[model samples]
Target: MEFSQLIYRKQRRWNLFAIAAIVSLLLFSSLYLMVGEVFISPFSEVTPLMEQLVLQLRLPRLLTAIAIGASLAVSGAVLQVLLGNVLAEPGVLGISGGASVMMVLVLFFIPVFATPVGFMLAAVVGALLFTLLLVSFAQVARLTTTRLLLVGVALGILSGAVVTWAFYFSDDLSLRQLMYWLMGSVGGASWYHHILTLMLLPVLIWLCFKGQVLDKLMMGETHAKQLGIDVEAVRWKLILAVSVLVGGAVALGGVIGFVGLVVPHLLRLSLGSENRYLLPMSALSGAALLVFADIIARTSLDSAELPLGVVTTSIGAPIFIWMLVKNHDSR
Candidate 1:
């Protein structure tokens, strides 16, 4: 009876988290659409220009935020479990940096990547390549969590150097575009971007279903395999999914940081580490957080919009510092 009650209590908490996330997502998404450079009331009549603004501009941007937030947050959660560390953001783990490097390389050299599919492929290739490098390095060095983070940082620096080298030879227009992407923005989201987002939503759903397998993995790889989890296959599957998702996110939203690092870790601490609740909640909370941040980024300054990364970094950097301090003190 006590065990059943405990299970019921856990379920209740999970439901509450899901409800809160949904409510927040709906509220913020509405605010994101309605409150912009000019306010548009959802119920009231508006001009064609306003209608177009909401449909063509704000909606796509909003959806892009959702896609990026959900994917990055989930990816971060998965990586934290896979790497057994808190500092597993896409940017930190070289995933986003890798994508950025490949993206710039393609933009500078490959005219075919001017298309959306080519752009996505380049980012995926970069992310996968970096994943391989990270795995190899970790295995070769027998990396502890700290060492893994350091290696990831080194990889990121290397990728940045490559991108910087490309920058010198690139034209001014490409340079400006690349800089905007590096900084991150949803200002330019279009129907093409929406197509990518739609394709990705199902994949995110599939990832959420991976929660059970991920939960098993947290118990240790050997234990998971003993329990018939196909540990290695699951590992590769998740890494590939994360690569595609992170690659898609970087391609779509540019290297927006900390959503993955911050969101999942916080959720784990607050709500408990059960992936079933954690994964879906992370997605919703991530979407809400990004929408909130994006709102602040564009609207905070009069007649000027800020980059998404600047806003997130300003907020996340402090949280990150606090996390490190707390973890260090605990140790």
Candidate 2:
């Protein structure tokens, strides 16, 4: 009876938290649309200017932010479980770095592939290749989690070196564009990318439902196998899923930092380590966070917008430090 009551109480708490998360996402979404340079009241009469701003400009950006945010957050959550490390994320794992490097190379060498779609495809391919490479290293080297993370860091450094070389050779126009992409911004969002954004919905849905698999894996590979889970098969599937999520996010948003790292950590601190609650909440919370961050990026300056990555990094760095400190103290 006591155990039953405890479970019931936890469920109630989670339900309330879920409700709050939904409300927060809705609130931020509204603010994203309404609180830009010229503040428009939600209840105000709609003008043609307002219509264009809402539909053509703000709506797509909002969707992009939401999609990318959720993708990164969920990816981070899964990665933490897969790698058995709390600090694992797309950026930290070199997935985003690989994508960015490939995109930059294409932009510098092949001017014909300069379109958004081309950039996205290039990023996905880069991410997929890098993911496969990481898997190969793990399999061949029989590395531990810590060693694997170090390998990822080394790969990220290699990617950075390649990007820097491109930067050195790029023309002024290309240099400026590359800098903006590295800094990250969603200002260039367009309706043409909506199909790609919409396609992520099914992927996100599939990932969310894998909470049980993630939960099992958290018990370690040997234990998970004893529990009748095919650890190797599941790992590959998850890696592929994460690669897509991270690649799509980098492709759309240009390496926006810390969403993956920060969102999952915050949600875990609040909701505990249960993947079932953590995954969906991370999705909603991540979407809200990115939308909120984009709002700051849009309105923080009077004339010029701040880069989206700058805003997120500024917010996430302190939280990340605090998490490190807290973990150390707890230990």
Which number leads on lDDT?
1
lDDT string, candidate 2, 1-331, tens digits: 9999988887787789899989999999988899887788988999999999999999999999999899999988988887677877787678888999988888878979977778777888888888888777766888776688789889888987888777877678857776786767888888887766876778888999999889999988888999999998999888888877887888888877778889888777776777888899899989999999999999989999999989998998788678767756766
Tell me how far the alpha carbon of residue 87 in candidate 1 is from the true structure, in angstroms, after superposition: 2.3
Q: Candidate 1, overall lDDT?
A: 0.86
What is each predicted model's overall lDDT from 0 to 1?
0.86, 0.84
What residue pairs are clashing in model 2?
none
Evaluated with TM-score, which candidate comes out highest? Answer: 1
lDDT of 1 by residue, 1-331 (tens): 9999999998898899899999999999999998878888988888998989998999989999999999999999998887777777888777889988888888878876666677778888899888878777666777886788888889888988888788777678868776776778888889887777876788799999888888998998788989899877887888888888888888888888889999998888887899988999999999999999999987898898999988888878899878878877888
lDDT value, candidate 2, whole model: 0.84
Per-candidate clash tally: 0, 0
Q: What is the lDDT of residue 222 in candidate 2?
A: 86
